[model samples]
Target chain A: MADPLVIRGVSIDDTFAEAFPMRGARIILTAVNARWARIAAHTMTGFATSVIGCKCEAAIERELGPEDTPDGRPGVSVLFFTPDSASLQQRLIERVGQTILTCPTTACFDGLPDAPERMPVGKALRVFGDGYQSSKVFGGTRYWRIPVMEGEFLIQEDMGKVKGIGGGNFLILAETAEVALAAAEAAVEAMAGMPGVILPFPGGIVRSGSKVGAKRYKTMIASTNDAYAPTLRPITTSDLPDGVNSVQEIVLDGLDAPSISAAMRAGIDAACRLGVIRITAGNYGGKLGPHHFYLRQIMGQPTA
Target chain B: MTDRITITFDTLPSGGEGLELDGITPDRLLTLSNAEIAKLPVWMGRRSVPLGDIAAIQGELSAHLRFEGDLARAEGVGAGMASGVLDVTGSVGDGAGVAMRGGSLRIGGSAGMRLGAALPGASRGMLGGEIVVTGSVGAEAGAYARRGLIVVRGDVGDSAARGLIAGTLVVFGRVGADAGTGNKRGSIVVLGSTAVPPTYRFACVYRPTVLRVLFGYLRRAYSIPVADRFVAGRWKRYCGDISELGKGELLTWAEA
Candidate 1:
């Protein structure tokens, strides 16, 4: 019986964002300093935007303090997600070897130590030492030391994998492109560094949001979301209102449902400001994914 | 409440013919009553005798098994034990923890030869579990061990970690001659100074990140005295047993 809650001048949608299950693994990289740690992390996560083409999606989870790392050095934690554990393992070995191992004074450790499922990434990479690699067991976990040109590179024998949620997304409809960009920035700022979640897109905002299938091409898996396009509003079915002229999206991937919900709540709250016409979510009729984050419910409003 | 069962020697055997007390582990006794445990048979020399004939038994089954008095004639004390804690206040005979699968064995006094070593015909020794010795152990400690950990706070006799196939052996004191000989795969971390065998080829001196996790675990789990210098120091890695797989390593503490 309560009236719909409104923040600033923007209206909150009643739809929910559908999220699919993904296999994820967290890798912790430590370096001599924070600068090299970030360099390795950024290189490892590069080109890993979506599983559609990159075969995996990865992002820097957070910057870890020296005490947080195994070697007591500055470190960065990265979260990688794939459709399954096999693919997750494959991408982990390929990325960690090419980026982390190649970086100066960097060592890789498993971030998800408590996860039951494990993948032998370092075990596979140990061959790079060409029979020179040695392993050490500390506490109970095993780590492999590979002799690199720059001293030695140490990595955990196995990385832990767990089931995570991906493709939790929302769209921002605004009266102008500038307004939409500002709102997206504000939403990203609000949701930055939230635990168990990562905004995979660049700057945590996506401009080219896509629909499930192509309009004309049968082979195309996805096409531009023409319904939200201001230019195509006259030709196609426009989901936008009269004053809405621009739209951008924020896609989220998290370790669980609660994390996505918490992030969405904070992001939507920051986005529901002046010039933003409405806040809506992307979903496939709640049929594809098991997790659904209702916009209004997350904003503390009763669902219709 | 003290849930542990204490067993003290009531009548000490005269000879050193070795007693097979493999069944006296904590996990095996956890289900038995005091009388039932006392009736358990232990092989002495060529004959079997009731455990109560040699030791005074008290308390019911618990997570811990405490043994008092010198057990220097007790061989296979915790062999093949899968779980629980075995605390020995005195020295034990040879093959004390041979072929153990899991659990922890802590010895306060010296141990005889082949501590945590393989059984007579078994391919591997101490497949899983941990053995901690506060006093020096005799020859061939952790020989042919496939997996698990063995920590020696005192000097280790000759041929330590011989034919090791994937496991860890940490010697806080001096490692005797011929240590890590013919080891296929495993790690031998020596904190005290010792002569390296010619078979081991010096690889490099570097700090291993795994030791941080391991040292931290040892410091917290067993309250083992881990020097900050050794925990945070570089180690001289030597790949050895070239006559075998040459995959095993000997990491000697270099500096703080």
Candidate 2:
């Protein structure tokens, strides 16, 4: 099958990464300046690494220009995903309340203004103003102005929710930890600022790739991916090559299938550099997720 | 197939009874032929007259309906219209847009009393839609309005927004006395000078972000002349009608 088409000495696996459906919402946080906007965004996305423990997965989608925001201020776009819309609304209210509302000179708006499904995130938080809260409808959209310790906090009345795909991932296998880290960084840099896709891990790199369930612990929903562990080569069913010493994963969540596919192309292309041994994907057969992004097909190579 | 239907006054009706032309809205005429539109009845001085007898009908109805000539004796020009655009290039009588539910009504000239105001026996006025008057308007412009927007480019008479429930009224010119006496929940923005009622308590002066959005929309959608100073200026807020719900507000331009 075309000799398994190698690019820059790195083998591309034919397998695909399985991504499941997730409920997602995009929030736009604007501030007096970029620094404060970033501060609020980072704080709101904090403790939201994965739905396994955090009940949600969130990350900064991208930095938005003034023209891209509703209030014409420096802004940041963030995406939050949960198992359902109910949990998504709960997490959004709690995080937006604890972060953007408390941050100085920060205002929040709905990034997905055209989505049909809406959740009242700001309406739930307006009670913080007690009897002093006021609402204004501009351009047919309602916004609540709450009197905060600062001047005022303006938040859109409703945040939109849509069905998205999550857990699209690929494993970067390299000969050393440093090589794996460099490749992961290059992959993240390539995929950064891509519209509708987010890498939720720290610096867009996941050191602890996980499997579906624990080996012995029945209560644990997930445990470490032992097959790819170099240290467990002798004890476990190792999936690593002979010279591979380290592996790092890049997990992606996106609004749709095409966005994840485009991001995977960019990441895989940038990661096929020197010291990277091979590129593979994580999947639990083909039953869990409806979307399957095959590496070889995405790279424009025929699959066997 | 013309996109607009023009109705020009062939013989201006002269009387104090005032003509009730409520059914001549753009939405109602959109699907009717010119012959059918002429057959629609309009009340004139206690007598029902065909629309073709008073006005010269031309063009087929579509999204826009244009009225030409002076209509100072014509009442309810766009009353109860729910959708489409109604453009009047002449002065209109009282209740120009009374009890309107949706759509936009643009008057190129002056209007009589109770523009966009609630009809008699009705608790609420316009539920939605927008009205723009380029000339002066008479008293009680948006009285008891539930939800809508009214922009007046000229002066307004006394009691402009009496008993307003919830909506926005922006007056670019001078306003007479008792502008918002018993408003329960609404906003009256006076770009020009206005006499503030004693019942309203002065609130803080700040630049609301929503104003910028509204100004931007007005400039883009209706081609209204929005001064740069108003777009960037701060407004002095006054909360009032304490005798009622005490939720209404009057925002006046502090400078520029």
Task: Score chain B of each candidate by TM-score.
Answer: 0.95, 0.96
Estimate the TM-score of every prediction.
0.88, 0.92
Candidate 1 yields a Cα-based lDDT of: 0.88
TM-score of chain A of 2: 0.98
Cα lDDT tens digits for candidate 1, A134-198:
77655467788888787778999999999999999999999999999999999999998888888
The complex in candidate 2 yields a DockQ of 0.36
Clashes of each: 2, 0
Give one digit per residue, the lDDT tens place, for model 2 in B158-185.
9999988888899999999898988988
Task: After the best TM-score superposition of candidate 1, give how far the Cα of residue A180 lies from its true spot, in angstroms.
Answer: 3.2
Candidate 2 error regions (>4 Å): B1-18, B30-35, B56-64, B89-91
